[model samples]
Target: MELALSVLQLAVRILALPVYVLHFLGLWSWICKKWFPHFLSRFTVMYNEQMAGRKRELFSNLQEFAGPSGKLSLLEVGCGTGANFKFYPSGCTVTCVDPNPNFEKFLFKSIAESRHLQFERFVVAAGEDMHQVADGSVDVVVCTLVLCSVESPEQILREVLRVLRPGGAFYFMEHVAADRSTWNYFWQQVLDPVWYLVFDGCNLTRKSWKVLEQAGFSKLKLQHIQAPLSWALVRPHIYGHAVK
Candidate 1:
């Protein structure tokens, strides 16, 4: 009976794939571009609640590079909903970039709420191509939960390196590929295509940390972590800094 049910489910997903593809090509892009960041901004509150301790540590790392003096310039790639706004020190300038232009409104709201961290500008650009930003101009580059969905992780990292000044920091927190023996890993591999179709190209099994290490960062610090068991498929994560 279970085998039959599994087969039925797979057949349904297979049938849905074309529909998803069409939606992505049609109105889905508009919807995602318009409201996805708002959804993420609210979702982040609950997400932070679930991983409060980890978030604290991540923000601490951000502060070390940004510092209290706030003279630093930060360029945040995939700055969805500006969740990191409050964590930044006062006097620092922040430039937010996201492919989803709808995030601009939410980012403005976040900036208003934040006591520190001045808004520099909002750029509508993908992580793979950030030509609007000048090379070696930013003191810190931030990426959180971003690489898994980009068309080319390597290209995005190259862009990160190009934008950051020498000895500048790249702060990141990302969900990544899981251990092969785990049930979550098995399902992640099996469902990746459908998952991407539903979630705007988010991949469940990317080895993001390894990609960052190979990107020629002069210094790297990384630690693996597991999310709450409730979100099993995306449980594995890595968060740290890489200096260019």
Candidate 2:
């Protein structure tokens, strides 16, 4: 069993290498960096609006913990399509990054549709590195629906904490495993193979909140919801805010 577990873990890493490689190809980068995001964001926004039930409730619940705004300096680690920033005041400037570098300049350029809106730049990098920004420089760090797609969520969370100032908050929203439910194991087991191909190594059963707690971020306010499984099967979703 131990050997099997080790192999399972190694397999996950091995599969991710190709995804990482694909991130560099300009053609595919156009897909992940631009196209997929455009479609997925639309689908998600539509779901949030048309469904108008538990999923939206989940977003609302997570919104409660978001810090009040006043030109807050924000960092979004995997700001694929820059969707959630639509809700923030333009004053809350965001430094967004992604692995795909081919994104159009305007897609990344900071724009203020409103006086409160301020966007800075879109960078081409992954979660394992955010060295461009100095530590503790940001007022708040956000990553929404991105943890699963990252290579090492545990490491990424640590990086997020490292970059955030003391007393700064990390506001994230992602799908995680349902505690103690057979669905948790079932989701990972069933989807682990195909998910790599479909979603750029995004896993369905990462227990990221537990990973965050272990990484020393405390005062977590999180909501776990079991959405009617459709897009990703047997998966549970979480949205929360935490402090480093």
lDDT of 1 at 78: 96
- TM-score, every prediction: 0.88, 0.72
After superposing candidate 1, which stretches have Cα over 4 Å from the reference? 1-9, 15-18, 63-70
Scored by CA lDDT, what does every candidate get?
A: 0.82, 0.66
TM-score of 2: 0.72
| lDDT tens per residue, model 2, 1-244 | 4576557756775767666466546444445545565555555665545334543443343333335453477788877655565555434667887775543343443243334556676768887798888898787787877887788888888789888878788877777766655645654755465565556567776777777677787678777776554565534777767877
Candidate 1: worst-modelled 10 consecutive residues by lDDT: 61-70
**Best prediction by TM-score:** 1
Residue-level lDDT for 37 in candidate 2 = 53
Give the lowest summed-lDDT range of ten residues in model 2.
57-66
Model 1 lDDT per residue over 1-244, tens place: 4575477558758788765777857976676566567668877777767766776777675545653454788999999888877666677789999998778788888888976777889999999999999999998998988999999999999999999988789988899989977777767877776777667779998999889989999999999999764578887999888999
